[model samples]
Target: MPYVNIKVTREGVTETQKAALIKGVTDLLVEVLHKSPATTMVVIDEVDLDNWGIGGLPVTDYRRLAATSGQGSGSME
Candidate 1:
């Protein structure tokens, strides 16, 4: 069995978001890596806002950068 661990911030996480992430990852692993979703374990780890970073900056400043640019456009954000 193969295992995957994915970590993201916890502030805005939802069940649907988690499901999409898991499904997307599982799809890639199964289709590209020839892995079996039944046997593969994919885990998502959530972090506190204080712990994550964006564009060499902390998550605290991510929104400001996003406003300047666009959310999700920043490489590290």
Candidate 2:
């Protein structure tokens, strides 16, 4: 069996998207590794912004700073 873990910030992911991810991952493993879809496992983990960090700062704070600094879009959307 193949196990895949996917982690993303808990901001705006939907159930439909998560389902798609699981299906896609399983399909990929089946195609590439010849794994059985029935035995492949995919887990999605959503982490809070406060629990995730970037550039030595929390994701929430980093996003705020990035917005104020006129940097990148600073949003997943």
Candidate 3:
């Protein structure tokens, strides 16, 4: 079995999106590695913004700073 773990910040991801992610990951493994989709496993873990960090700062704070500075969109899309 192939195991995949996906971690993202807890924001506004819907159930449909999560299901799509799982299916996409599994399909990719099957196509690239010839893994069996029936046995492939994909796990999604959503962490709070405060618990996730970048540039030594929490994600929430970084996003706010980036937005004010116009340096980043602070969007996953």
Candidate 4:
């Protein structure tokens, strides 16, 4: 069994988008790892911006800083 956890900021995501995410993740697991769709589980958790942080600052603040710094990708990579 493969369990996948996806976390995103609570930013007005639609049910259709969530369904797409679940399906995409399951498909990726099935293709790459040969996992069974019936045994694969994907969970998505929406977190508040204030609750998700990076570099000791909330995500909102981090994004703001990133925007100002011209690093607007919002990715920690």
Model 3 CA deviation exceeding 4 Å by range: none
How does each model score on TM-score?
0.70, 0.85, 0.90, 0.87
The residue-by-residue lDDT of candidate 2 on 16-64, one tens digit each, is 9999999999989988889999888899999987899998999888888
Worst 10 residues of 3 by lDDT: 68-77
lDDT of 2 at 15: 90
lDDT of 4 by residue, 1-77 (tens): 89999999998889999999999999999999999999999999999999998889998888888889997885542
Candidate 2, residue 40: CA error in Å?
A: 0.5
Cand. 4 TM to true fold: 0.87
70: Cα error in model 1, Å: 9.4
Candidate 4 — number of clashing residue pairs? 0
Clashing pairs in 4: none
lDDT of each: 0.82, 0.88, 0.89, 0.91
Candidate closest to the true structure, highest lDDT: 4
Candidate 2 displacement at residue 28 in angstroms: 1.1
Q: Residue by residue across 31-50, what tens digits does model 1's lDDT show?
A: 99899899988899999877
Q: Candidate 2 at 37: error in angstroms? A: 0.8
lDDT of 1 at 66: 79
What's the ranking of the predictions by TM-score, best on top?
A: 3, 4, 2, 1
Quick one: ranking by lDDT, best first? Answer: 4, 3, 2, 1
Instruction: Give the range where candidate 4 is weakest over 10 consecutive residues by summed lDDT.
Output: 68-77
